[model samples]
Target chain A: MPETPTIPDSPATAPLLRLSGLEQVFDTKRGKVPAVSGVDLKVEAGKVLCLVGESGCGKTTTARAAAGLTRPTGGSVEYLGHDIHRMGAAEWQEYREAVQYIHQDPYASLNPVRTVLSSLTAGLRKHKKVKGRHEARQAAARLLEQVELTPAESYLDKYPHQLSGGQRQRVAVARALAMNPKLLIADESTSMLDVSIRVSLLNTLGGLRDDLGVGFMFITHDLAVAKYFAWDGEIAVMYLGKVVEHGPTPQVINDPQHPYTKALIAAVCEPDPRLARSKKTIPLRSAEIPSLTALPSGCTFHPRCPLAESGDCDTTPPTLAPLDERRRLACHVVARDHVAAQAGTG
Target chain B: MSEEPILSVRDLRITYQTGRNSEVVAARDVEFDLYPGQSMALVGESGCGKTTLGLGLLRLLPKLGRIPQGEIVYRRKDGTTADILKMGKEELRRFRWSEAAMVFQGAMNAFNPVQRIGAHFADTLKDHLPEGKRLSKTEIRERSEELLRMVRLEPGRVLPSFPHELSGGMKQRALIALALALNPQVLVLDEPTTALDLLTQCSIVEELHRLRAEFGFTMIFITHDLGLAAELADRVSTMYAGRIIETGTAEDIFYDPRHPYTSGLINAVLPVVGDLPQLASIPGSPPSLATLPAGCAFGPRCEYVQDRCREAVPALEPLTDRPDGLTHATACLRAEDVQHSREVVSRA
Candidate 1:
């Protein structure tokens, strides 16, 4: 039993942002729709905690809840040991300023008519990061350089339409960093960009985490990217708004205890052609993800879980339980298998 | 491999007419062959003309688009080769869905929001069925159901549902099913799985591979994600600024890319294993198609650029230096240098 927990635990050190039993439900024309449910996550300074799942898995909802873009209907989001929703106006403003957001579509997020200089410097001035226009301009140029848009003056005057997709995304990053934010909630920030440019943007983000000590709540459907960018961080695998598995990045990616987690990892096609061709069969049990409006009984993944036993899996919902200090999983079969294997050895 | 290609494109040139009588060379000097049952992935950044090339083959260019020069010689089912670019309107319509069909990018969400899934399938069948071959409503329904099942969707539940009623993955699968309804010999998939989740994309790619094997169809899979392309395609072509810069077998492209652009593309992908290295992004964006740089389009961003590379364009030529002497073509003047070297353009 390997039980080396990577994240430190002590009363003196507190997590930067923590969400406990977070839930977001929308009242649609059909009925109540649970976009997110029973989600728990903790992000410390300088450490990323990526939320990975397919579309409609509530990864975005979780990120929005954490960023205070939308208040969850249930549970609480706490930052620095204080409930974010209950903070005073000044404290709330501080929290809001400290936590910034980067959306998926950089083209849509940026102002098309305004130049990058205005957008980048406006936030800096609003946040009181600079004294005057000249200082703000210099800061904006530095921010652009930080995101690797070289010779900052060259790109400073260009509008969003004038810039390429990659350049626009870099400007978005620069704008986000203008706040000197402690936490960044990026929801599919690079999914819209081309694959080659995506890696570079992720590299810039990883650099920000290292140099500026900014924690990221990176919500994406890309498992490979999450694993690569969050190398020293953690991964939370969600299914239909539930965190099925959460653990250290390597452990979660390598030894996925949950069936859903295993399926997700297996679905990622390796870049090598021989390896991809060798795996002729898809690991998923089914092609369909059950409707979120009418979620399956018990384990939400049971309908597509290969190891799911009919009675137990369809009747009793498995709660996320500790596999070790470093890993957590929510699967009836995995729990049973683990205990069975242990009993056989003992 | 068959001596006769199912489809061959030579000297293909495509340009889009912008405002003020300006023309943008979207695809220039594009050439490749699609063998029976083989999938070719056209990988590139946006505006590299991968989509333009695919659309050109199907002869579905818009009014503003023109193919000033090219020969898209598609081998017909009856052992005849016809230049699709010169085909008449009626001939093209007759050949469109029955011969080569395209599923545009984001086509899953491009369905008619007001129509049910079955209605769309029925519409395609009605529009493209062979002349003098009429099917009853019941027959069309049966065929729609069968097509739906081929893509792993149960028609009983999906046929009557509106597009909005279906999940994103379901919609994408349904689009694939719709594309296969007419039993086309060549399917041009434009980033069909780009917006899809990994699991969904995996299953879709597997289904596509199985379908190609079962039906013996030649497929042109266009995508920006090289990893997905490597998994699905038998051969890969990396495009840059309206040109095919590199063409090789999947293994050759992934393991031993010769073009600096191709190498940069492969290395840009974050490794699933090993420590996260500094990503080597190709610096500087691609030049405008209207006013591309002289010599090589990728010269400005390439790390292995030389004086000769900037003076004249290097034609995509075979790698005669290879031990096996296979036809791994690259358009880089310093192909040997890039082959011997590795990605050194690490972005800090």
Candidate 2:
């Protein structure tokens, strides 16, 4: 057997952000929908934690909770060992400045009426990062250059509509960087971009993680993108408001333990024609995702899971538990397999 | 392999009148031969004219959009040939769902929210029925049910539902069924599996594969996704700035792309199954059609670009010819110099 992968456990410094038992329930007219349930995650400075799942799988809900955008209906969002909801005004302001959010649509995120300079320097001016218009302009130019919108003066006076999708996304990144944020929560930031532009934007974001020591809670539905952006980081696979699998990027991608992770990875259409022809798909029992309001009993993914057993999988819900020293899984079948393997080895 | 092409487009130009005297050429000088039962993928970024070309093929361009100059030679079901651009109003109306149909990009907006799913199919069949043929209500229901079942949707539950009642995948499948209601010889799908979950996309791809095998219809799908193109297309065409920059068999396009833009696009895609490869994005964005550069549209961002590329546009020249007119061609001046190896982009 291959040796277990090891992620450096830095106990010396507190994580930049942590979500402990994070839960979000929306009381719609139809019913109470549990969008995110008991999700635990950690992002240290300069590290990435990618949340990969399909739509309505609670990736966005988890991200919003982590960003302190919405007060969680249950559990707590802690930043630097302090609960975000219980922080004082000074602490809240610091937390707000420390954690920034980059929305999915660049076209809609940036104000169409505001020029690039004004948008970039709005947060800076409000937060007193720059004293005057001259200083703000200089600071904005520097921020734009940091995101690789070079010769920044040319872009300073332009509106959002004048720039291309890729260029507009760079401005969004520049606006986030203006806050000097320690952590950034980017929700499907590159999904709207073309393949070429998407890769370039990912490269720029990866650079920010390394150069500025910024932690990222990147969320996307594209597995290839998650693999590329968070290769050295961790990936948490969410399925219907719960994390089904969590591990190092390479480990989860190459040797997926959870059936959902395996199925998702198998479902991706590789760009190469040879691979496309040779790929083997994991057949699901059902194609439709269960509705959030009417969730299935026990393990939510059990209905579609090919490996799901009759009594245990249907009667009891599985908790996200440590599968190995480096990974966590929430499948009963996989957990049983791990136990059996341990018993045999011992 | 020597069979006649069902759709042969030559020097096709689609333009939109922006002002009194100004017109923007969305697609120009586009030439290709789509053989019967062939699946062709039009791959490009947004605003690259793939959609415009697809719309133009069916004469479905908006009121402002017009086919200024081109010959879209289409072979009818009875083996008669006619130019789609020159078809009379009545002829075009009859030719549209009966000869060729389109599954638009967003299935949500493609459907009417108030109408039941069955009505969409009934309307299509009733409007496109052959001359002097009357269909009973029972016949329409039977046909619509058969179409829905072919796409794996239960007609009993789905037929009575509104567009908002079905999921994105179900809606897409229903739209495909509606498009096939007339049993058109050709189908045009724009971003069929986009905006869907991974598993749903996989099922849709599989469904399309099965449906094509059973129906034996020609297909032309427009998408920005290289992965989907690799999966569904037998022939791949890469478009850049209103022109097909490269055209070839799937193997040639994926394995040995000659155009710098095509190579760059292939290299930019990240694979999920293998080791992470170094990817390099082309430097600049696609140019606006209104103020296109002097010569090659991709010249500004192409690594293999030279002074020759900026002087004049290059025509699509065939590099290798195959059976059924499946020729590997590209419009790059430095086609010979640009290597197809993945290492070229990785090294950059």
Top candidate (TM-score): 2
Write one digit per residue (lDDT tens) for candidate 1, span A1-346: 1222344334257689988889999999989999998887899999999999988889988998899989899978988767789999999988988899998998899999989999998877776879997898899999999999989999988899998888898899899888889999998888888777787788889899999999999988888789888879999999999999999999887677887887777777666676666654436667778878899999989888888888889998888888777888899889888889989999
Candidate 1 residues B160-189, lDDT tens each?
A: 999998877888888988888889999999
- Residue A91 accuracy (lDDT) in model 1: 91
Error of 2 at B73 (Å): 1.0
What is the Å distance of residue B34 in model 2 from its true position?
0.9
- Per-model lDDT: 0.84, 0.91
Model 1 earns a TM-score of: 0.94
- For candidate 2, give the lDDT of residue A145: 95
Stretches > 4 Å off in candidate 2: A1-12, B343-348
Report the TM-score for the A-chain of model 2: 0.96
- Candidate 2 chain A, run of 10 with poorest lDDT: A1-10
